[model samples]
Target: MSVPVPYHATAQRPEWSSLPARLRAEVSTRMGAPVIQARTAGAGFTRGFAALLRTADGQSAFVKAAPHAEQPHLVDWYAREAAILTRLPAGLPAPRPRWTLWEAGWYVLCLDPVDGHTPRLPWDQAELTATLTAFADVAEALAEPPVELTALGLPRLADLARDDLLWWGEVAAGREQVPPLPAPARGRLADLVTLESRLPRYAAAATGLTHGDLRVDNVLVDTAGSVWFCDWPWLCHGPAWFDLVTLLITGYATGLDVDSLFAAQPAAASAPDDALDVTLAALAGYHLTAATSAPPTASTNLPAHQRWTGEQAIRWLSHRRGWL
Candidate 1:
């Protein structure tokens, strides 16, 4: 629960010069004007090429390029994100992907750049309020699943939770080793498993599309103080409160009265009484287990971020359950 470093600052992105000349030319050709300036995005864990490109004729676009020869997974993720963005409702406060193309063994996605910056840590009260309000609008807009959108084969959150979100159960059954824990939380694997295992049952009834990944780094605050969500590869059907929980974890880490803040949001209004506890338990298990695994070749800071997030989750859960 300590004030940790900014997660996004740790990423090592590909420079503009590192991109293939052919692909860069294709981007210029598509923009219909020579590139005048480019500023790389300072956030994200991936090593893909992401930057705001400005043309001599005053046109600007946010471009992301992933090389199939190297970051193949990133290519797949970026391609999937582009496909999802086009189908998202127009009223949502998310950036729209404008176009996508393949050139020189790389996949490229273009989007309209937002005039904004990442929210600062130890979040300003107004910024946090604005973000929560904007996402409430998002939850309202996607309350019901659209046939065309659902037809894209987005996985149901409950199914995903059952498959990949139960690390405590793994440890309880001796399939995975237990990670270090607080003094009071040690030897509580059965309790952790009990809480984490209920996620599927609790999430199964949800029908709305949720932003599967809702971290502070993925959010942008514009000059007008409006919030914009980015990165859409994890979109799925789940209760909107799940996304709210993910966004507010950092708030809790930073010492915000997130319990009350969460209650005030419309997204959490319909959530079950134990919904927050269930999510925090599952998150603690997932991140703690992940922190013990081998780090990705890229994303050097991921392990540290995972550890901090897991500890914060466990701290929140313990306080709520009176584990002390």
Candidate 2:
């Protein structure tokens, strides 16, 4: 039996212990700490549960558990995240890897706790500017030597769905009765899909690892207002614009000045600067799908899938019309 170490006040039990003995052990070992208590962290498709554990020596760590839910190659996806972390460029705000463990046929990720407080966002222009500057710098660093998404055990965007309708449609399937998808919104999605298909060719020419999901919620801002990216489960190798698009969409949704934010980066200056447009289209589809696919959890604010979808489409169209 492993000797029990002193539990830190900051440390708590994992939410999985009530689940099963195997999961408890798995969570403990991966975190390099003993499981004292655990619980649901929030409501997200990929993130189901999280916990705070304390090493016998009093270090607190975080353990996130994402179970496979009909997602193809879920195990491989988890492995890919670990791989991406291993190769993160110097000076970016990504979390440091602690350990990756497999237990009870589940992947358990233990990562060092980032030292920061969650910031009040949609950030002001200053904060958004700083974050984008950092993002552009990282993009440039990765432009030269791109890491393959699959090589790191992650799936490419192509693997995410068989077709645009099948991919985004399924996520919104259950929401047809509530705030039904407007016909114009549906048409817009189809149009975006047509444009997105051309992305592979464009992506091939540009370079770098994409964070895939750059929502402000995934960023940690300390008292000093410095930010760090936390989740890497969706890391991918793709066009530089992909990440910029993700960041811009997040800023736009959260009510920030995305243009000035992105302009701070020299690399982004020459890029198409259509990040916000693309991102709005993608997220409108994504959130609609998520609301349809997952069981209702408290964190999700999507009342009707199509409502979000239409609103997002309008935002995208308005941007295209230069209203933004």
Candidate 3:
């Protein structure tokens, strides 16, 4: 059989923003403006599409889309994101949301874009550290009990978990013509999967809110030094360490040893091994999904993301293998 496509194989392109005209019309009707076109803008992952809209007046607004597959009925992801933004403390860095809607099995959210640069590999540790703490503050304040993601008409963490195991996990395990990972790494992953199987028992203890996906790529820092997190499709309340650990591992894989950087945040650094396991599993699940969806060939743009992902997979395996 041919090699499987990697998760989010399709790059965010110009047309990913092609919402049904009716949706566009609805946008125009709701916003009371004639939208000329919703131009594809910026890179996004794990959702329908994202773009920027140019109104008849030449004003621009960033747009993110969630198709039916992402949300079955209510558009909870979109609603939760809006709620998070609205609840955000004044003066914190994030995009200014203009509107959000659930229409025709699609959830659309529009916000004002902040001009900024996407940080490359080896992220600036000092900048990232401060930004992370700030983000954590916001996330912590926004933390709440788990909401039925599907009640808002979107897939929940449970849905993504099932899809990951059945689809992405199987695909990763089935790669035939791929370069072999080091034996140590291979042995490591086997152990991780075994350990992860016992997570349900510990999961009940990790109650609260989390950003779900808090990696660096999901963040955008503008030229004026403002940071914006674009995608909110996977927002949820769970383990407190979930967001921090995700950021740390992503930071580590990208050559920034976040643990060293955050050596000052002793409280955060003191997270136990068991919590790390859960965080690693969540991160691993994302990597496996990406590996399943991605083609064998690598891309320059996502090197950090891919490298970090690969490294995290090994870390998970090692922990599972009792190496940790």
Cα deviation of 71 in candidate 3 (Å)? 8.8
What's the ranking of the predictions by TM-score, best on top? 1, 2, 3
Model 1: per-residue lDDT, tens digit, 7-94?
5475668877778899888899999898778888877776788888999999999999988987898998898898888888888888
- The lDDT of each candidate is 0.86, 0.53, 0.54
Model 2 segments beyond 4 Å from truth?
Answer: 1-17, 25-40, 66-74, 124-126, 146-198, 273-279, 295-310, 322-324
User: Model 2's lDDT to the true fold?
Assistant: 0.53
lDDT of 2 by residue, 69-99 (tens): 4322545655666777777766777776778
The runs of at least 3 residues in candidate 3 whose Cα sits more than 4 Å from the true structure, single-residue gaps closed, are 1-10, 14-39, 56-58, 66-96, 101-107, 143-180, 197-203, 262-270, 293-308, 315-324
Error of 2 at 128 (Å): 2.8
All candidates: CA RMSD (Å): 1.4, 8.1, 6.5
lDDT leader: 1
Error of 2 at 274 (Å): 4.9
